[model samples]
Target: MNTNRTPNPPRGDGHAHGFLGERAELVSALLALTVYLTGLILELTGNGGPATLPLFVAAYVFGGFFTLREALLTVRRGRFQVDFLMLIAAAGAAAIGKWEEGAVLLVLFSLGHALEGYAMGRARRSIEALGELAPRSALVLRAATPVEVPVEELVVGDTVLVRPHTRVPADGFVASGTGSLDQSAITGESIPVDKQPVADRAAALADPAAVDAGSRVFAGTVNGAGALDVVVTRLARDNTLARVVRMVQEAEERTSPTQRFTDRFQKVFVPGVLALVAVLLGIGALTGEPFADTFYRAMAVLVAASPCALAIATPAAVLSAVGRAARGGVLVKGGAPLEEFGRLRTIAFDKTGTLTEGRPRLTEAEAADGVGPQELLRTALAVQRLSDHPLAQAVVRDAPALLGAAPARSAEPAAVNLRAVIGRGVTAELDGEEVHIGSLAYADSLAGPPVPAALRERTRQLAESGRTTMLVRRGERYLGTLGLMDAPRPDAADTVAELRGLGVTRMVMLSGDDQRVADEVGRAVGMDEVRGGLMPQDKVTEVARLRAAERTAMIGDGVNDAPAMAGATVGVAMGAAGSAVALETADIALMSDDLRRLPFITGLSRRAGRIIRQNLWLSLGIVAVLVPATVMGMGIGPAVLVHEGSTLIVVANALRLLRYPDVREARARR
Candidate 1:
């Protein structure tokens, strides 16, 4: 049960405000520019003494205010930051009686800072948008009537009435009635899913989303034309929408490899710049240069050495790419995973629920010589009703059509005694006759002659076709075998092909199913390697082996897969919209069950990594070129222009990541 409602604040903290909040720095920069222009006109006209000096002074004050605060903060913390260097440069210009030049430098520097803040704000907007999706209040049913309440007040097992076109206020299962839902907030699907009654517990266990009208409804999704009575399954704080918001907020704060590298570089780089400036000043003074000229040249060094662009290079691109990924239905948990995912050399996928849909369906059935297929199905369905195993539900689903009516519990024969053997099968006395259904080993242990060799061969054939087979028996006779298949996702092959196209060096399928079944699924999905009959820990061992050789990513969705997923370099949870555990444990969560997004995410991450490298080089290249020029006698004003211009260019380069198109279109272009 969850208790909290509001998600933690996102990295940027989007708040409603007048233009001041969004553009304070921009406004200040504009004012400084205006004052500088006025001072220039007065100085050029030569009546500049009283009017021009005050205008330049005012311009410096307006523009330097923001920079001064940052510089002061850095100084108080005993740190050398780019802002401190800019402050020293501005003061050096004024000390040399170049007040107008100082004012222009401050104006450009402040403008660049303002623009960077605005660009970062755009990146943070993606997480903030999620905060606005779920409604704050919902109508709850009480005493056979409806009453409105804060979403936080709603608890598990409560019934909530959702009117047409209203956003669902909590995570729950549809209890009654039916409706289509705009589930984009959860699954990122553009179309609505039609709600129907859910199946029994076994079916639901096989695939949590398979329940009929009991289809899971997530908070924040809009209800369609018909009314839906949803039974609250999770409290307000535990809803899928809330978790999405929380994860996004958390992800933004984690540093990427590039960001960490930049931080390390700056620690040495900032102090080194200060030392270089000091050396220049000492050498100029000792060489008998005029104090004004010496100090002016040192100030130029300060302006040229500030690494504003270098400082923001990685964060700008990283933030933009993370936000873009979220909008495309993939939640990259943090900068670490995003960077790691881009370096994937191999991707290991789980078979059931990943490469294939989790739901099993009956594919083939054979009967003993005397019994028809329908009679065998009826007995299997009746026996399965007492259990909810995935294979049992598959048989139950097929029995209704054969029986020409829904299977009724009352119609099932009363069993005098019942027993279920885990991992083997079940035994029961129905209509005073002994009955058994389970794996062939279990059937062989019962009071029956050996199963026909032809029947055994048929079951093996089904397994080769990627199906699970069960043996059925009645009294002393062998009934037959039922083959169940959990088919691969429609897009599984395409996803594999696209990943290979995206430079995925290897693809492996790891499954708990039989080896032959795993091989069939691997072949169908074009997997490069296949390993089967793995227990949960075996999967983890395989993931570890792959990671030891090269970077590896494991994609899975189940409680058992959690450990294996956690062991991989990057863990991707498929169909995360339906599983809370997947949402919490996965390094990356795919909101939709769509496998196609895997390739898309790979491409997006690779593109982001490339852009970060580009930004770093561009920023460093600018410093490399401009610093030497400034030391060789470039003027303070021109150095300021080049330095601040490079800052803007770095920001512009990072903003290109925000143009990340739809995943499908991106893949198509690739």
Candidate 2:
């Protein structure tokens, strides 16, 4: 969730004047302390009288003058804030001749407010740290000379030079350099991305460009070990960093379910407290108690049962929990999303780019005919070297190293004749000899002869086991078979086990891949069910179906997963490799692309929810006990003490949710 607050200019005339004002507040606090001490000394010396009353009054005035002023302003503006309640409680204490109680109430309430302010300030500072990661200026190249300029001065189509170790100034395409880029600041991937000039061209040609020289890069990402000249494609304010800031702000603005319930409860709760105070006063007056005693009792009841503790409990817990989540690389969209996580019974995950590594890998290669194994390997590598598909690249990567020098690099294979049969293989001429690589169907169609029974059976076995088998042939002769598969990520099994331990009972793998691939990966990762060959909308329908059974979370990292992610009870996005739609749509973003964080965040959310419930109960229980006792002739001093103590307990309990040591350690262990 976005924790960013709107930027406000510092509220000081100047640095010196600001310091002076802070000193003045300090002086006021010290003066109030002295007055409180003087009153206590007078009481201890057996001289408690009108003089002591004046000292107590002086303590209240000095400590709470600003609070009272603000309270009055809010009242004039037709708003009733918590400060107004404190002011009323303090004034009532004095009116009841409880000078010590009034002094204590003012001093303690002021201190609590100050402490809350300090905590909020610290939280704001942590959020601001994210904004500071982006550089303020860009080094633009003009006439072959580099000129440093403010980032705001950059525009679309302008070329800027980024040096090693500096944050990229804007979202842009690299013009003429290759390097590694660290996108952890934006996507939370730990590995630095290797970029090349050729890769950049291919990426740019793709609707969404790849990371390479001349490929677009975002602000706040770091360039590693190389200098790059980039053509700015997006203004500074419209870059990925800015979008993150915007998303966070929007998330924060969206009210959580808990907040809505609390707000509705308060609308009735405040009036109920007021009615109870009136009833107590009426009963006391009818009993013929002194007017002063009845008034004191009534006001004490109001102070004892204000429900302020309840007001602060849930929000404080949510704020603290969200802050801790941010530090741990999870962005919970809002308190509602965090609360929903604890209720999840089933989690549906996208297979490609989520449960399994999105990339395909070469698993096995076997010669089918008398053709030598080395010849088949060489032929496969030569043909695949000209293609950029992930499967083709995987095949080339798996080829054995040659004896000495690297194979000659070619822009494209040069051959007298070439043919590509989709879903099968390709045939081409190399040094005037016929060469081919592809599937069995394409090979048999070309040969028009009896198919080899052994090769067909092997291909069937591989296909049934979720492997893509490619047949290589030359002219009318069969060569060999190549096995390719989209393997499960190494960490997938451990992450699934962790989620099970965290109470996720039903885990389903959903993918657009074939059922064979889905079943294979699902079994490896311990998923309870597998649904494959699903389009984006189909995934959404499945998520909705799961939600009917119980609360469901959808975890994914691609455009196809966007709708399903949004439809789940709590959407989790793998920040790294996640499409823009998925990142923006998911309720929570796992910044590090590590599924292990899923269980850790789930544990944290459950713990936070429990803490919130405990705080709510504690605050209500305290009021239930204290209000009745105060009505039964308890003194104002004791009642105020109990009320203030309960508030402190609630605040302290709420703050404990911010202790994230265990959450961090959990992720580390995973």
TM-score of each: 0.88, 0.87
Error of 1 at 197 (Å): 5.3
Scored by TM-score, the top model is: 1
In candidate 2, what are the lDDT values of residues 399-487, reduced to their tens digit?
A: 65531244565633454455666767676776666777666666667645545888888888888888888887655666778888888
lDDT: worst 10-residue window of model 2: 8-17
Q: Which 10 consecutive positions of candidate 1 have the poorest summed lDDT?
A: 3-12
Local distance difference test, each candidate: 0.80, 0.71
Q: Can you write out model 1's per-residue Cα lDDT over 314-413, one digit (the tens) per residue?
A: 8777777877777777888878899899988899999988999888878778786777887787778777876777777777777677566654677665
- Model 2: runs farther than 4 Å from truth? 1-33, 46-51, 69-81, 157-168, 171-198, 201-209, 212-218, 221-233, 387-390, 400-416, 431-433, 576-579, 662-670
* Residue 215 in model 2: lDDT: 55
Model 2: lDDT equals 0.71
